[model samples]
Target chain A: MLIVDRVSKKFNVNGKEKIAVDNVSVKIKKGETVCIVGPNGAGKTTTVKICSGFVSPDSGNVYYDSISLLNRKKYLEKISVLFEGIRSINWALTPLENMEYLSGLRGIKKNKKDIEKYIEMFELGDYKNQQCNSLSRGNQQKVAIACCLCLETDAVFMDEPTLGLDMEISHKIIKILKTYAQTNKKIFVITTHDSDFIEEIADKVLIIEKGKIMFEGSCEEFKAVQNTNTFKEAYLKYRGVL
Target chain B: MKRVITVFLNELKYSFIILNRYRINWMFGLSNLFLSVLFLNLGIKSFGNYVTENVLDLKLTQMIIGLFVFIVIAEGLNNIISKITQAKQSGVLEQIIVNPLGSKYIFVIKFFADFVIVFISIAIIIPLTMIITSKIISFNIYKLIILLIPLLFCTLGVGLILGGATLVFKKLQSATHLMQFLILTLMVIPSYPITPYSFLPITVESMAINKVFSSQISLSFGLLAFLYAHSFAYFILGLLVYSKFEDYAKTKGILGHY
Candidate 1:
């Protein structure tokens, strides 16, 4: 389980301070899939980064199973991250090379067979040897997912995992993630504005507005609210737009 | 300690892969080879003219030693500037910053990688210089190796300092050009006798280069040791400055500023 306590992050823009994340606290239990929904600049990415220890918060702390998250090597090893950008992987290397290199970094000392399993699982077998830059956006996302799952960490942080993916590929990714969550009991924390995807996969939903959590509940409870039939309506209602 | 080594190995692996993928290593090697030949020819021509004119009583081996020092300094500075600039452009800088490793480790690995590349170029240039000018110049391998160390340290130290500056200024063009010019002046001005200029500038330049090329003193090894110590001092100082500025850099979102 991960607990975020009163975390705040601020950045200076042209000598002016802008708060990206307010004093917000959240707890994510083990074996659960939580989706955070927010518009652009709503501090979703910043919160994700703080939780992942990529960016230190201006105040408060993050604890993973009662241990401070700052500079904790063991905690980091248990988490895998896929940031929003699709080009995070080295584009010059072939997909196979990329996977091999990352797996090596993670101390996976196996050969082609183990890597081939991930390639087949992600449906990337045909493009396994191709350079990442040459692959289509959807295919590149598959490679990124394969890289993340290769580590097979207990918890995964995916920011906009399905961004730029086609419907067919998106469904495949969701199905895989659902199956992984059920079988491995891995905790998946995803931040996205894609309500359809969230509705399909997320067990719980947290709506954030202007760096604050406006609402938090089960997806079913969220849908039971009047005019909350769609994730978009729920988001709009939380944003006070309706 | 193991984690530091792990991060170091990762950086080295990534740098080697990137270097090969972009073909920069091969390009740098080829260019260094071409320039070393060109410069050696120019140095030989100038030395031959000096010998005919009876301008100095130095042996051919002595002239070759001087030319070797000049090439090492020149190529060392060039390699440093280009590598740092390319790293900035390649998004490697930002990637290193985000990792759990400290900035000092990143700078050190980058410096060592560039230093190795420069050292390889120097190795090639030295042998080629020996071959092409063998008829005119003799070789003293031990003296050559001894003279090369201080020059390499000085150049590497200055390169890292400038690289840290690149992170601050976010553009390496001006800093790199100025460094190249400064290195050239340091090499060429000292080749002439030290007495012709104003006493102050001459004294300053002489002391600075001597500090860099400490082995020239030929006394106890204290001066050479001091030079090495000072090189590390500058390296640490650069690391500190980079670490402090990195916080501001993150706020400015300047990790990708280049």
Candidate 2:
């Protein structure tokens, strides 16, 4: 479980301070899948970064399973993050090589069989020997996901994981994530603007506007309160639109 | 400590993979070695005349050692500056920034990797030049070892500062040009034992060249200590700047912004 307590972040631009994330708070439970939806410049990414320990909050603390995240390696060990358009693996390395390298970093002991298992599971066996840059976008995304899952961390934070993926690949990724969450009891927190994806997989929805939480509830409850037929309607209504 | 070592090893492995993938870099290394050897031959041909004219007190062997130091420092600085710029352009910088590794670890690994590349070049070029110019050049193993300490540290320090600056400015081409200019100036202004003008030139030349091959190791040690202290200070300052601006860089959605 992750608890974010009144986290805020600000940036200075030309000697002026611009607040990105305001004093916002939220709680994510284990075995729960939460998706945060927001418009452009809505600070959803910043919130994800804060929760994942990539960006330090100016005013609040993040807790992982009741442990202070500040200066704590155990909390970090429990979390794995995938930022949008960010390739964490070395481009010169192959998919299998990247996986083995990251697994070594996480101190996971595995031999050739284990590595091949993950490669086959991700349907990346054909491209396992290909350099990362040579792979297609969807295949690269698969490799990135494989790297994260290889860590097998309890909590996963994905920022726009489906960006630029075609419908078929997108559905495949969603299914993989859902299966991972359901089978392993993992906590999945995704920040994306895609309402269809949110409706499909998000058990709970957290809506943010201009850095503050506008609403938080079960997707069903959110739909009921807004009297919407779709997640888009609920989102628009919560933002004070007709 | 084990974690630090782990980070170091990983970085080393990554560096080798990246460097080996680029066939051009190896070509550049070979060309650089050939050029250094050519210069050493030219210096040897003129050495006797220079000593006969009472222009130099040093042997051709010492001149060759000086040339080796120059080649290493030049190649090291150029490789580092260009690599940092390329990393930013190629999105490698973003990948590194998001990792859990600390900034100090990144800086140290980068510095050491560049140092190793330059060292390897020296190892290859120096021996080849000595073999070709066997009659003119002689090896002083102890002096060579002593010379390496300061030269490595000085080049490492300069490389770090330049690499960090390139991250902020993203004007590596101009920065590299300026670095070349500075190195040339440092080499030429030190006059060989000829005149008062030669005094400043000789002093600068001796300082630059002796740091890598002189028998007196203490001066080189002191210079290395100074370089390290300054390099570390700049490294910390650079990290602070990076942390301060990183969020802005991310929000602006410009990973390779100047």
Candidate 3:
């Protein structure tokens, strides 16, 4: 289980203090996929960074399996993160090399068969040996996401994972992630604006705006917010855009 | 312990891939080093026509030794900042900084990997320089290797200091270039038996390297001990400065930005 207890972050811009995450707390049990949906600058990325042990939170602590993440160096071994707009893997290296190096960097020693499983699963067998920079943006994103899952960490945080993916590949990813979450029993936290992704993969949804979470609940409960048949209408209504 | 070893091994593989992929660049750099050494030797030897044969011979030998030390130490001093800047531009700096073994360990592992490459390049360049200059100055292999331990530490220390500064303030090309010029000056300075300039970074090590190659001057135990102590001091200071800068970068959340 992962617990973010009242985490807050503040940034200074041009000598003015701006709150990025405002006392936000969240909990995710093992095998659960939680999606954080928010507009740009809604602090979704900051929240994810704090949970992933990349960025330190100012006011609160994050606990993974009841162990505090604050000042805990080993906590990083248990998590993997794919930040938005960042390839997260070395572009100068091939996908296979990246997988090996990244996993080794994280202290995991997976066999060739286990590593090749993800390579084939992502349909990257053809380009696994090619430099990642030579691949198309969608394929590059696939490699990045595959690198994350191949680590087999206890907690996986992906920010805008499907941003550059085509519809076909996006659906394939959703299927893969859904199955992976179920079988692995790991904490999966994602931040994206893709409604289909949110609807299909998220067991729980967090709608954040202006650094604060406006709503948090199950998929069905979030959809029932406006008595609507579609997740889009319910989300629009809750965001005051209807 | 296993994690450290894994990180080290992977770092070697990663460095190898990069080196292999950019073979042309590596070759070009090696050629550049050779040509620079050749030109430097010829430039200094131009005055050889006026001096006595023995004086010119000694002068040229000292010049070659100083240039060799300069080339070797310069690689260690310049590699860390270049590596960090390249990683930052390529969007992989954040991943490296967040390595589970801690960023410090990862950087050290990378330093060792780069040092291996540097060592190999030097092995190639040393023979090439000797053949081109027709100066077969034999160095004591044992003493040379022993002396390099402190020199490598000094290089790593300075590299870390520059690397930490790069974490917060990116784009340090001009600064690094200036540093290279200063290092060149400090490297070629005449070594006094007891001079205050020995306290400067890379000075004592350069003097010691010159001594290793010069048959006339023998290295003293006190000098070797001082070199180790001084180099380790810089290493420790560099680690502290780097840690502070890393924390500041994490606080500001600019580690991934350009």
Best by the TM-score measure: 3
lDDT of 2 by residue, B138-191 (tens): 446775555455455455555666666565555555747766567656555643
Please identify model 1 stretches exceeding 4 Å from their true place.
Answer: A72-75, A103-114, A237-242, B1-25, B52-95, B110-119, B135-169, B172-177, B183-219, B251-258
Q: Which pairs in model 3 have colliding backbones?
A: none
DockQ of each candidate, alpha-carbon based: 0.25, 0.24, 0.60
Docking class of 2: acceptable
Candidate order by decreasing TM-score: 3, 2, 1
**RMSD in Å for candidate 1, one decimal?**
5.2
Which regions of candidate 2 fall more than 4 Å away from where they truly are?
Answer: A12-17, A66-69, A72-75, A102-111, A236-242, B36-63, B71-87, B90-95, B132-162, B165-168, B171-174, B183-258
Question: What C-alpha lDDT, on a 0 to 100 scale, does residue B11 get in candidate 2?
Answer: 56
Docking category of candidate 3: medium
Fnat per model, in the order shown: 0.04, 0.05, 0.53
Best by DockQ: 3
lDDT tens digits by residue: candidate 2, A191-227: 9877778877898888888798888988888999999
Assess candidate 1 and give its TM-score to the true structure: 0.78
State which candidate, 2 or 3, has the greater TM-score: 3
The best-first sequence of candidates by DockQ reads: 3, 1, 2
lDDT score of residue A188 within candidate 2: 92
Model 3 Cα lDDT, one tens digit per residue, A1-242: 88899999999989999899999998889899999998899999989987876677788989888878864577776788888433577888888888887787776776788889999988999998999889888778878888889988899998989886789888888888898898989889999988889889999999898789888998789888678777788888877898
Candidate 1 lDDT score at position A197: 80
- TM-scores, one per candidate: 0.78, 0.80, 0.95
